[model samples]
Target: MTTNQPGHTFQVDLRGLVDLLSHHLYSSPRVYLRELMQNAVDAITARRALDPEAPARITIRTGVGGGITVQDSGVGLTEADVHTFLATIGRSSKRTADGDLDLAEARADFIGQFGIGLLACFVVADEILVVSRSAKTPGAPAVEWRGRSDGTYAIRTLPAGTVTEPGTTVTLTPRADGSQWLEPGTVLQLARHFGSLLRYEVAVVDRHGEATRVNDTPPVWERAYRSPLARREALAAYGKATFDFTPLDTIDLDIPLVGLKGVAFVLPTPAHPTKRSGHRVHLKGMLLSDQATELLPDWAFFAACVVDTTGLRPTASREALYADETLAAVRDAIGERIRQWLTGLAASDLALLRRFLDVHHLAVKALARYDDELLALLLPWLPFETTDGTVSLDEFCRSHPVVLVTQTVEEFRQVSSIAAAAGLGVINGGYVYDRELVHRLPQVRPGTTVTDLDPETVTAHLDSVDPGTELAAAPFLARARAVADRLGADVALRSFQPVGVPAMLVDNREARHDRRRAELSAGADDLWAGILNSLSSSAPRAQLILNHLNPLIRRLAELAGTADPQLTETAVEALYGQALLLSRRPLRPSDHALLNRSFLGLLDFATQAAGAPAADNGTKDPR
Candidate 1:
């Protein structure tokens, strides 16, 4: 069919695109040179693959008035290729859009999949002139395409005198405002940051006709695959280089074919290790993200790793790593890695592992509560009480005569009973409610079962009972009940038989000590306020259980019976204050006030008793 009139093609405003390229695409203008160098590297990599034996060289020449010119002896682009690359938006020559490309399959071969590197030129250059002769055809005519930021472009054959053989030379007339691109220092800086990992040699020609290759292309990624290196060696080298190691405890969680790599030891802790790091993440062998925060769980923020997965889309500038299913797999892999690392450490070295537990106890605890699967794996690393001081779960199970494993509180009570029947101490170190659930041990196991007890409660329970009299603690119990009711606390009186301590303030849950410490260190008032509100409300209520048999309580009781109110009140106030301190709770305002007044009275009494003037000891009137 013949068309009567030609349809108008959609045209982009290159000026606006240039503005976006310079101001929006790059946060720092210094990266303009980096983007150009990366493009040059891509061209070199493609060319070398075609002619492996050929010597590949790139020449960059610049002067104050001449602007910048880059010439590359690579597989030069044809007019058709130029139209497809520059004129088309989505037709990237680097990446394949196949629906099913296995990451494992592709990682062995091709890289640089997304093609948008050329647009970076618009950032600094106001005008671009491309002179290219195709390598595929002999005696092919050299063509030149010129374009400006205004979107106007023209194509014509280059003059015979300046034509080059089988290569491409791009001349960039940079905007006066973009003189930084021509500076040797600026070019070197760009190469160091972005092109340091480039396999090809990148050089710049200074005003004196001298060429300087300013990149270390043989990065660690290119090291011998079979090189034997120790962990400390790698860490030391990374430290000396003044770059972050950001160690990753890498564990491949493939069923049937599992791989575990412990790389966590490589990460260097920053002088001020915040939640951020400068580590780049790679998927498989391809660079996915330089800032891969989501690759790890929040708990693993302390860890820094370059997670290279072969399952992401790298944009043209080789900057953005597009998110996809590969990211999910990465998350799973890292979580499993951390889980296995802790588990293996726990099972192997008990003493060495305890140090890790001590340092990261809060992180461990958080993982235990939220990640039960990981918790089960990490439990072996956790310290537990044993017959011979502190032991790990593995140690406890291995040494104990009767070992019990259960998830619920009732199951814990049953375990306690079994231990008691055999005259052994039951350890309830399982889940969050494991400690609180210990109270049911007596009921489940009857009088024979000695349940696990907190150290504080043990002291109070042991001291509360009198050895001689079984039923003479009535007066003490009555006063404790009155105190509990006044404080609106949960009150209970049970035999401290399981624990050895005389009495303890029991009922408070564990504090978010790590989170609080972090908040305090950060000086985040809003975060602190939120944490304080939650802690005060959710913290377990404490009951003051009096040790009726203890001489201190008995003496106080006898003194209370006396007609002297001042001494009795002072003793009561002191005991209450001691209890509050032990329980880690704030004392009631009236009680605090009473203690203050009684303290003043005691000072006066002591002064009078010592024969000092009583007037000097009296409270000073607020004048």
Candidate 2:
């Protein structure tokens, strides 16, 4: 095992590697400017370490025929440094002790990093030329490195005055298709887009010989304003400019441990609860990403944010954050900041908080479902649809001893008007997050009684008709029961308030499930029919409650006893059909056809009666 033979290094395909970087490693070729800026900023940081008063400046100029020259006043490289860093891939001297690049990367200082950054220029350029004069060795000769995309490089010591300053100038000769990205307008935009927040004097010089400075001031969130109103207006304006919509409010985000600072602008309009929130994020004052979605909690989709952090880690492409414990901690910390914003609203800004709830109550309800503190603070102000009318939960709870809730809007609508007359408190829990939030009502209020509504329970509270009246109506009741049987329902006589309503559809959850199963079984194949049939229940389906107090029903009953049977049958069927339609439930296909047939039959009967002469006995059917 002690052979003294020469070792051979693996040769790399530079073209293939560049293709990989362009297609997979980086999001787009636009990141070439970011890589160059990162190198320049790190070099300046190194120079600052050597001399505290060193100038930290970076300048970019677009040369003739679509070439880009980036010059930085930083600590340049020696000949050996050029050979080691520029000539090798995935190799750098800026690593930490023990050479481990873990989640805690060593990028806080001006030390150089992974050699892949310079190679990213190959994504756009065919060749890269670098001229540098070392700051470490003031008397040493400057070095020039010319690297091409064909896996070849040349480094040499340049004579005096070739590079007069102790810094580096990198020039890129773009490929045929990269000329657009190398133009003066594009170069200036890319420079400002990626380095507008860098902690240095950065500027872009165009072909017109004019220089426009970038990163000239701090971020808007970090600046001081004259008054609170002015600060609010400025933040709103910034949000509108950045996100294209003015924010309803702004929440300051700070995590000292990670050196993360941000402003989360609460979106003004309703935001989808499931859609991800993409927040703008900057790493070490450099624009890292505009759509970093992992920095906030899922429930915080109601915000669009701009953040800058010095401690978070970026991926190799410098496009997104590295998912690690630090990122998790940062996400949790941001969630805590948002929670504080909501709690602050509850304590001091009641009107504004109510407005927020009106627009984003679904988001709050999602948060409240698991957060005990938030549940207590927001439960009183959250609105719900109840028999008493749409009002806050606190208002509904104070008036009703027992709270009745329906799992579907149809179920609530079927009995809402009637329930109100019966002194029942029924709330619609059909909306997203509403049922879960209501089920947790007891956690917020100790004595709150919450139960799912059963239509049968509502039916039981209805007043019972006297035995004499029931007996007198026996003929009509018998006919009505037979008619209801064909429709898969049971008929009953009840007396309720506001007798204008002729009949009500009271459908229980179990009956609804059974009806759905029955409908499926009718269309299913033999095997599926058997399976569905077994799952169905023997419980009765939707009930048809005929209001005995309604004048129309009373007249119909009288006709049922004395008039022709055909007339009574048509009246009973029409009453049940009207009730079913009012429930707002989807009608079965067979039911729809039956309704159509009945209307046609009625039209035929009316036409015959209209054309025929007046009855000799001066009497007509009450249909």
lDDT of 1 by residue, 288-308 (tens): 345656656656555555433
lDDT of 1 at 430: 51
- Number of colliding residue pairs in model 2: 0
**TM-score against truth, every candidate:** 0.66, 0.91
Which pairs clash inside model 2? none
Model 2 per-residue lDDT tens digits across residues 355-442: 9988888888888988999999998799898998888899899988688998889888898888999999999988877777888888
Model 1 gets an lDDT of 0.52
Q: Which candidate has the top score in lDDT?
A: 2
The candidate maximizing TM-score is 2
